[model samples]
Target: MHAPALALGALFSATAAIAHLACIAIGAPAYRVMGAGERMARAAQAGRLQPALVTLAVAAMLSAWAGYAVSGAGVVGPWPFTRPALVLITVLYLARGLAFALLKPLFPGNSATFWWISSGLCLLIGLVHLYGLLAAP
Candidate 1:
């Protein structure tokens, strides 16, 4: 199995998931630092559920993506539709990274730093996943 690249991709996704969960636990400051916008931070500070709920949903999806990567790597038992799932995940990350420039207007609340860092990370992870999948026997 093509283990290395997929393993790295899994690691990246899992780390991001953990970070998202941490933002929820850490509250307003975390939200702001993560470029989640002042509105989200205010909602978090106000004890509204929206920020936490949205963060949780994102974290859960990231975790699932990590699991798919691990499954593709043969690091665990095969998950259902592992190959297809990996392809989709790869495409998702790549698309997100590549489209970030055009999508800036759509996400005006997020900081430029956030966009740069996130886009770079997504591109890296997407490339790793692509390499792993392509190298698979």
Candidate 2:
């Protein structure tokens, strides 16, 4: 009925950490799996993507904790910030996911289909997280 706080949180957390690690040293082949286009691949080749992805990974870790807290598992003492924060996080994620697909000018060189599918997955993840957050007792 609700989110698997421990499991899903771990999933998110591990995903972030590993993605960061991949960016740290795996190079362009990894970015290819992430659907990076020519320009992005250039960036990776030039070694610009790693720092950016690593920075994002830090935020992703925070998001994982937010997901856990909103699930009502491992919630810290009586904080009033959970509901609104989760709402905002969910909205932002949904926006980011959907916008990537709809905005034609974005991520030039990558196939629209890839971005669309990836964005759809992001939206699905966000929605599932929202469902658990809203369902929390």
Candidate 3:
């Protein structure tokens, strides 16, 4: 059980690293080239990349659930901060999805603000997970 927790922690960390590389490294350059309108259109296009993004998002949610499970399994006692942080992270991700769905027009042109906001939310969520892993008893 402890090993699973540790492994899940490592999984979370690795996923975060990959996400940063994909979004910051590959995605940033791609966005700069395409511009926001094209980027939004590309995102809207049903293809390989969008499914991959959805998979990544689902994996992240599952990883968080695993961490919560591990914590509950007595490998780590309940940490005061972990649950709320996780909830906030979930909310941010949900909000991003909702923004994409409901506010599509807001995303398509010169919308660096959307990118920045989403990126910041992802970073905060990653940080919170790392903190939970480190602080877990």
What lDDT tens digits, residue by residue, belong to model 1 across residues 1-137?
A: 49999999999999999999999999999999998888899999999999999999999999999999999988899999999999999999999889998988887888898899889999999999999999999
Evaluated at residue 50, the lDDT of candidate 2 is: 57
Q: Give every collision pair in model 3.
A: none
- Model 1 Cα displacement at 73 (Å)? 0.8
Candidate 2 residue pairs that clash: none
Q: What TM-score do all the candidates reach, one by one? A: 0.97, 0.68, 0.34
Model 1 quality (TM-score): 0.97
lDDT of 3 by residue, 4-93 (tens): 444444455456445533543354344444344455345635343763465357556656654554453346675456556555554554
Q: How well does candidate 2 score on lDDT at residue 85?
A: 59
Q: Pick the candidate with the highest lDDT.
A: 1
lDDT of 2 by residue, 1-137 (tens): 25474336435545655664565466667656666566666677787855457546764765554554434444344345656656665676578677884665765777666587667765766776577666777
Say which candidate scores most in TM-score: 1
Q: Give the Cα RMSD of candidate 1.
A: 0.9
lDDT of 3 at 53: 61
